[model samples]
Structure formats: structure tokens, C-alpha cells
Target: MLRLSRLTDYATAALGWMAERPERIVSVADIAQALHLEAATVAKVLRALVQAGVVESFRGATGGYRLSRPPAQINLVTIVEALEGPLGMTDCAAGAACEHALHCGVSAPWQRISAVVAATLSRMSLADLARPVAQRRHKEIA
Candidate 1:
């Protein structure tokens, strides 16, 4: 099963919390405390986000992090790609060097599936993920 790494998961949680206070400069400690996460982990997550242009970091006594853009503009793919790199769902997804590269039966189908997944992620934003679980629902897959 494909799943995001724990670091990426923490990044989404930290980002979702920050999205709630988009204008505020949030310390890693504060976010960690509020989200019941580790300060070091949050710090690391924020660093990746900053590098990805997903969030901005401030420096000074009051230095912290804030969303570089509105939550609606920062989509899930941006976050996932920030720490995890592009979404390559399979060994054959990215023209990766593999024995299967030559006439692989599943390569084309899997790449198509990966594209659809990426498109879905593009439509999902940080704001959407920030909603409470009870307030968020998904249609059943047909």
C-alpha cells in the first residue's frame, strides 16, 4: 500500500494547524505543543516546507513560520512533493531504470493510474485537509 512517510504526515498536520492562523508567525514549539507533536520534528518539517516555497520562515526573537500563500492555493501535491519528492507510485512510474522498462505489461496502466492520482491531489488543498474529520467526507469509489 502506498502511504506518506511519517515526516510528510507531520508536515500536513503542522501545515493544517498553521493554515488556521495564516497570518500569524508560529514557532515550531508552539505548533508541536498544539498538535501534540515533537518540536524537533515540526522544525524539520517546517524546513522542508520553507525550501518548497509552501511556507515562509522568519528569523528573530519572534521568528517563526507562516503559510507563504493562502491555504486554498497550497495543494496537497505541493506538500507531498515538498518532503517526499514527486509522487512516483511505482518502480515504473518515472522512466526509472528497471528491467521492466522494456515492454512492461503494467507500466502504461500504472502510469495512467499515477496521473489520475496526481490530478486528484492537485484538486485537494491544505484548506480542505484542515477541515475537521467529521466535516470532511469522500464519495465512495465506484
Candidate 2:
């Protein structure tokens, strides 16, 4: 089954939390407490996010993290690539020239699928994820 890593899930939750309060500079402890996750895990996730240019980090007494860009500009593909270093269902899909590349028939198809998946993810932004369930449902219905 296709699945994201636990860290990726936590990263999304943490990002969604920040997206919900984009104007607030939130400390790691605050995010952990709000999400009911371990502070260390949240810290790790935040570090990755900071490195990915997704979140800006500050230092000092009131220092905290905030999104580098508006939530609407941060898409799932960007987040996923930030954590996973690019989305690839298979080695061949990631542009790794396999030994069988010359004879492989599925390589092109897998690449196409990967492209579609990436495009779909690019369409989903953090702002969308932060929306209330009722609002999301209403949009879907409409």
C-alpha cells in the first residue's frame, strides 16, 4: 500500500497548525502541546521544514517559527518534496537509469503516473488543508 512516513504525517500536521495561525509565531513547545505530539519529534520536523524554506525560524526569548510564504503558496508537492526529497513511486520513476532502461516497457508509464501524482499534489495547498472540514465539504459539494 502507498503510505507516507510517520514523520511526514507529523510534518503535515505541524504545518497545518501553523497555517491555521499564519500570523502567529509559534514555538516548538506550543506546537507540540497543541498537536499532542512529542516535542522532540516536532522539533525534528520543524528543522526539516526550516531547511526546506517552508518555515522561517527565529531566535531569542520570543523566537518561534512561521511560514516563509503565505499558506496558499505552499503546496503539498512542495512539502512532500521537502521531506521526501522528491516524489517517486519507483527508482525508475525518479529518473534513475536502471539496467533494464533500454528494454523496460513500464518506465515511461511509471514516469507519467508520477508526473500526474506530482501535479495533483501541487494543486493542494496548505491553506486548503487548514480549512475547516465543513468548509471543505461545502466546496466539494458545490
Candidate 3:
């Protein structure tokens, strides 16, 4: 039952929208309107992204937000971590102390699985998410 939070999902959608128009400075209101999400939610997501250095914010009247780097340079791992803190399949996998740590034999396996998940996410860049399905498949096939 592993899943991303609703806010994280919105953040990805917002980021993907921006990635498609990387050269544009997009207002939060516009993003909210386009994504049919609440303005406050979009603002919150943008603030987190800005704090994480995933997106840069402009503070002028005509200012808005844009990605801090190219889509290809930003991976899902970075985005997920930025939105969700860190990817961990279990408490121990995230380095938290567990009451059963001494007796836990599955901890090592959980850590390994977490590492593989992290690596898979790292390999998937924002550019991949931004592209059309056909384009992504073509790239994967080539």
C-alpha cells in the first residue's frame, strides 16, 4: 500500500506542467487553474519546491516560479525527496530506531529494497515525466 501523498501528486503535476514550458515563469494561480487544484495547495507545493531548490521563485509583481534546473537534470528521487522528505519502505530503512531492531532479521532486506527503489527513482528524470507517452516509449526503445 505504498503511495505518494495527494500533495506530492499535485507537486509532480505542477512540475510536469512547468517542465513542458520550462522557459516560462508560471504564476501559482495559473498553475492552480490549469491543474484544477486549489490556489493555497499550489502555493504550498511551490513553497516546498522553492525551499528544496527544485524551483526558484521570483518576487516581483510580474514574477513567478520556474525550475531551478533543466528537466533532464531533475530526477524523480529529488522531487520525491523534496515533497516527501525521503523514500523509505520501513522505519529502519529511513534510519529511525525501531523497538525490534535487535530482533529484526528483515531490516537488511528492507534496506536493500529501499535502495533499489531509490535508484529506480533516481534514474527517472522530470524530462521523462514531462514527455508524451509515445515519446518516452520511443526513447526507451532506442
Candidate 4:
């Protein structure tokens, strides 16, 4: 089955938490406590995200991490790429020149589907995930 790894899931959760309060600088410890995640893990994720330009890091008594850009300007594709490098359903489908790529029907279909999936993810900005859980559920129900 297709699924995001636990690290990616945690990254999304952490980022979503930060996105909720974009104006506030949040310490990794506080975010870890708030999300019931390990402080070290959150710290690592934060550092990587900062390096990828998704989050800006500040050093000081009152400094912490904040999104480098507005939620609307960052999409799932950006987040996924930041954490996982690139988006691809299959190795051969994502421009990898494999010996069997030209002859494999499965590769062609997966490539087409992967492109659609990438497009869908790229279209969903972080702002779309900033909605309250209740509101999101309401929309899901409708």
C-alpha cells in the first residue's frame, strides 16, 4: 500500500502545529510537548526543515522556529520534497533510465498516475491544512 513514512507523518504534524500560529516563535521542546512527540526528534525535523528553507531558525532567548513563507505559499509538494527529496511512485517512472522502463507497461501507468498524484499534492497548499479539525471534518462530511 502507498503511505507516508512515520517521519514524514510527524513532519506534517509538526509543521501543521507551527502553521496554526505562524506569528509565534515556537521552541522544539514546546512543540514536542504539545504534540506528544520526542523533543530530540522534533528538533531534528525542525533543523532539516530550516535547512530546506521551509522554516526559519533563530537563535536567542526568545528565538525559535517559524515558517519562512506564508502557509498559502507552501504546498504539500514542497513539504514532501523538503523531507523526502523527491516525489515518485516508482523509481523507473520518475525519469530513472531503467533497462525495463521502455518495455514495462506498469512503469508507464505508474508514471502517469504518479504525475497526477504529484499535481494533486502540489495544488494543496499548507493553508488548506490550517483549518480547524472540526471544520475539516465538517467539510469531509458534506
Per-residue lDDT of candidate 1, residues 1-142 (tens digit)? 7788999999998988888789999999999999898898998999999999999999999999999999999999989989888777886685477885787788888889988988999999998998763244323322
Q: Which runs in model 2 stand beyond 4 Å of their true positions?
A: 133-142
| TM-score, prediction 1 | 0.89
Order the candidate numbers by TM-score, best to worst: 3, 2, 1, 4
Q: Would you estimate the TM-scores of all the predictions?
A: 0.89, 0.90, 0.91, 0.87
**Predicted candidate 3 versus true structure: per-residue lDDT over 46-81, tens digit per residue:** 999999899999999999999999999999988898
The per-model lDDT (C-alpha) reads: 0.87, 0.90, 0.91, 0.84
- Best candidate according to lDDT: 3
Residue lDDT tens for model 2, 1-142: 9888898999998998888778889999999998899999999999999999999999999999999999999999889888787788888998777999999899999999999999999999998877774376568999
Candidate 1 displacement at residue 12 in angstroms:
0.8
By summed lDDT, which 10 consecutive residues of candidate 3 come out lowest? 129-138
- Which regions in candidate 4 have their CA more than 4 angstroms from the true location? 134-142
Candidate 1 stretches greater than 4 Å from native: 133-142
What shift in Å separates residue 106 of candidate 4 from its native position after superposition? Answer: 2.2
Model 4, C-alpha of 84: deviation from truth (Å): 1.9
Indicate the worst ten consecutive residues by lDDT in candidate 2: 129-138
lDDT of each residue in 13-49, candidate 4, tens digit only: 8888888788789899889998899999998888878
